[model samples]
Target chain A: MNQADSSTIVVKRTIAATVDELFDAWLDPDSLAQWMHPGTTALSTASVDARVGGAFEVLMHYPDKPLRHHGVYRQIERNRKLSFTWISDATQHSETLVTVEFNVASAGTEIVLTHERLPGQVACAEHTQGWTLAFELLADLAAKPLVLVTFDWVPEMPRGFVRDIRVRWALEEAGLPYRVQSVPFSDRNADHFSHQPFGQVPWLTDGDLSIFETGAILLHLGERSEALLPAGPRGRAETLEWLFAALNSVEMASLPWSLLQFSGNNDGTPGWNMMDSFLKKSRLAHLEPLLAKREWLAGPFSIADIVMADVLRLVDRFDGLADYPACRAYVARATARPAFLKAHADQMAHFAAAD
Target chain B: MNQADSSTIVVKRTIAATVDELFDAWLDPDSLAQWMHPGTTALSTASVDARVGGAFEVLMHYPDKPLRHHGVYRQIERNRKLSFTWISDATQHSETLVTVEFNVASAGTEIVLTHERLPGQVACAEHTQGWTLAFELLADLAAKPLVLVTFDWVPEMPRGFVRDIRVRWALEEAGLPYRVQSVPFSDRNADHFSHQPFGQVPWLTDGDLSIFETGAILLHLGERSEALLPAGPRGRAETLEWLFAALNSVEMASLPWSLLQFSGNNDGTPGWNMMDSFLKKSRLAHLEPLLAKREWLAGPFSIADIVMADVLRLVDRFDGLADYPACRAYVARATARPAFLKAHADQMAHFAAAD
Candidate 1:
């Protein structure tokens, strides 16, 4: 939320990093440079002394002009609060006070930013927008070192469809930077459970928060950018409902059926018959009409689409979606996105590299 | 986030209702009475006139003090913003300015409340806490009319373990108010798919957000209180990671195996053997040590416990936990909670009512 007046601006954001991690991101020159710019690829240059009276400077490489912002540390209460005197071209080259409070909250830090002694209403408004974009950049930058916990390699059978691909698709779509860390499929360790309880792969670690469950990972990543989840209400609601619909509603049944397909036995047995009917009637039949009506699950492509299309791709792989044209089309539409293609290729290469 | 100084108080919360719905919640006296009180069960009295220059009164019945808050609306922009002059005991009976801006966010409204012209620092601080508490109460009350979509009835085989029970357990634990809406199991309709794409019961409809996937619903309810998800970083992270573990990691394997058991066939087939081995080696074996070490999945019993215990209960029913005492004990510990017992009894009665 951003609230501005004639002389001050306040902004707050809930982030998935610890107070210590967040506090350091500000004072550490290298870290400060990563996300201090407007675009994900745009990196700033920063120098920090990081003491009570230390000096710090960040020069943002804007396309129009290189904007310079410099400040001196006014207060530092490690992991709790930080205050500095800020000066920038946008601030009329006059010093303004910026205080950041890092409140310990579930999953990360609740960062409250107060920029006081603004020149006037215009500066207040501009600074409000400036900090908002900076935080967005900061979030995108945080994704750079994100550790995506996944199986190093599996047999060719599940190569492209492994759950980690869902997280990959979202990250690629958002254009967030990340590197993959893998655990061999046949080897799971005690340390793995620390990241993922049931010992499955595709848990995401960002700063202090380690999130598992492919669905949960997708949901977590969805919060990072509007590309994964639209910031608008209607689209967001549709994306969420459909995201769950993908997991519980569609994949919930499709997954079991796909597993049976993989085993390639008991084709006409009682259990097979029941599961087959459930997937066709309870899952696919109900989903076909809805898919035929919408371009994506939501208005634009979203994290829900990534999850659902991924879920549907499995069914298509096993020929389970032979009868649903709309479902197949929806999958095609989603996978055609450059993000999905890149994610898929990277997953294949990751397994290949392990080999 | 709540930030206050001598002259102002600012509080913002991302809530799960439409801007229109949220805007009306402030001006509709009847709606205001439902959630304007501190406690979920405690109802306040409210009277409002929906226009600029109109007055509104809300008398909250506290344990000892019947605090009265009255305000005259200065500006009213439907579904956008509302500005008023507020007078209350907490503000030292001062006629302060309160402006509420409703921004359309993904799932609902991002409500920004700015209370300015406070009497002094004490008044500002007190009002900040007061507004935070009031917003918390509003969120709890919004859960009042939540409709839990579930099956009317199913056969005895899946009766005690319908997925809806997971949602019910969280609701009971959080002490949130809700009612069940039954969709007949055999009669799957388009209406059902609208709420649940897979036509599986247990999607939740909370105002504009109809979240499906038992996992997603639990996460949504988790946002309402600390009982479901603690507000601390570690507990919250554990709950999230484990909640997904139960769904994608544990249940992902258990459900298929359970379905085979339900059919009472393919006991020793290759597919059954593979599934059995997977359930034991990949899931339970890895889970036992972690479960044996901790009484609850998180620091305190959390929504993750609700999901994991329910998942384990099903596997236990099939005699799957025979060799895993730790998993068995963990399930028992979770089920032994009063909230779990109430949720179980109510689920049983709900099915029996259909009969």
Candidate 2:
């Protein structure tokens, strides 16, 4: 067995709409507004350019706040393949890529999303957990039957990264039933790579559909559930903006900061110095203002909180996050959820068994 | 000015809608579906999670082929900031980050987007040009009066990259007026960083808005005019997916292939050998399939083709791309556009001035 063999979480659900209708929900601005948010604010004014080499952008607004988010379409294939580049309104130079695939299945539209080329392994793990939870939420919103497959590896299973907790919390919040498919790291193999293109664990397969990357899975799940996202235009937009902030803005900064523990040899190498500088200027500096403004990053207890809490947990592992009181408090709120408890317990049990 | 300073390109445009309204268009999935794809198809579904710690995803579908794109939100600041990660369903492992900011302006929203933390300098240059053209497309979609601001630097003047052709084409396509501000590279003052985040040329500003990266610029421009995108759900989705394939999938592969020229040095290193393997495995493998199926990358002549053509042009620069008849045909189709001709002529004129 190898690291990829160990599985930690599983989800199953049935959607209310047909495969084509459910798939169409992704393209239609109105349908998107209907089920995009779990329980926060609703989406307002959805717009898109659905074409080859066409530009697509969306703005989501919160009624009481001034927050918003924008995205551009990188690629689009009707009901089959979609990809784009994403960035936040807050920073100038940080960008990430996301892709989702929808395959028609006997059961329904089998959706598989793969988010790749992350900065490093740590990011991969963090996103793996976050995406798992979000997908659960999506299943709930779509009222569709779905399944999620994930694993927990030994020796390097970042215990501090609490993204699993978020997934668990979303499931609990939605009052959904799920199962676990724990695979020991010793059992991982090439087959796992077939499921996860990168060979990393924490992948999900819904019937014939399979998805890798935590962020993409989370989105798939979130779109299905009403408990994970809000129901109105303003609320939904607010929720969406926070989602971007958590994955792109906060997570981007935290990845490098958390990696310091593994790479910090205290040597005078240029790479170390560069990493250190990035930690100071890029990660820490931006986080300060972000945490100071809100109790939950956005409004209510959305997936944004889940992703941020997980990222913060990793930062806390190295004692780097002690300075941010808001972040610490936010982490506490997210972990308090019952689903988070279940997810964490499952991870611990799986890790113990592997040991 | 030196050769580096001679080839700089500047682009700009204006968009209607208030700063908040325009900003909301980004966060709201519904609004995104509207102007997002100006000339292509209508958006089928648009979803968002606009919160700090939330996870957001948008999937755009095509009208004809089996292509779909999904994006995840990473950051958010009410009405002021947003960011997210981008990935492709095809590659599934490569991820990139993008960010945008909305400033409250008396006239309208001054949106500034920054796409950063790319793999390296080569990727950075290509992204800058691609983003610029995208922003130009955005401006056209928005249908607001706008202007273009550009700067000339001695070292970074004509920022030589393939995507510049796309930016020039977008400007001509929209028939938008633009101006340039020349800066000598010798003057590495703080102001340079303010105009061009990386201190490179091809930076742009419209009214209170300032942006860097050709892709972002094209999106901004496309938002102004509806002509850049298709008109229906499937058409718009196809356009967006093709855009992503051009930038993330196709361009990514082409970049490494082109870099081989720089690596074949007299230093007696194995750079050429590494480059050869890279081209044969990565670039050729992907291009073969992409060219076999589509006449244009996505459909018709969208921004995706513009960017793809520019990137593929490099293939001819090093070795002839004639082997790929489909790719050659696509290039011819793209170049045949009147807008492309003007952009090419403008670029040539700029180069001619350098002599």
TM-score of each: 0.60, 0.40
lDDT per residue (tens digit) for residues B1-355 in model 1: 2353568888898888777767877876545665666665444666676789998888787868777989999999888889999898877787989999999889777999998888888887777787888888677655566768788678886888988899989998998887566688999987886677666778888867777777778877888889899887667766776776777667778887888787786468766777787788989998899888988877888888998899999999989999999999999888999888877866775676455
Off by over 4 Å in 1: A1-143, A184-187, A232-237, B1-143, B185-188
Cα error of candidate 2 at position A62, Å = 41
Error of 1 at A33 (Å): 22
lDDT per residue as tens, model 2, A76-173: 76766777664444323245556777766677666665554444455546545645654554565566434345554466456534344455556666
Best by lDDT: 1
Worst 10 residues of 1 chain B by lDDT: B34-43
CA lDDT, every prediction? 0.79, 0.53
> What is the Cα-based lDDT of residue A243 in candidate 2?
58
lDDT of 2 by residue, B189-210 (tens): 6676555433444555666655
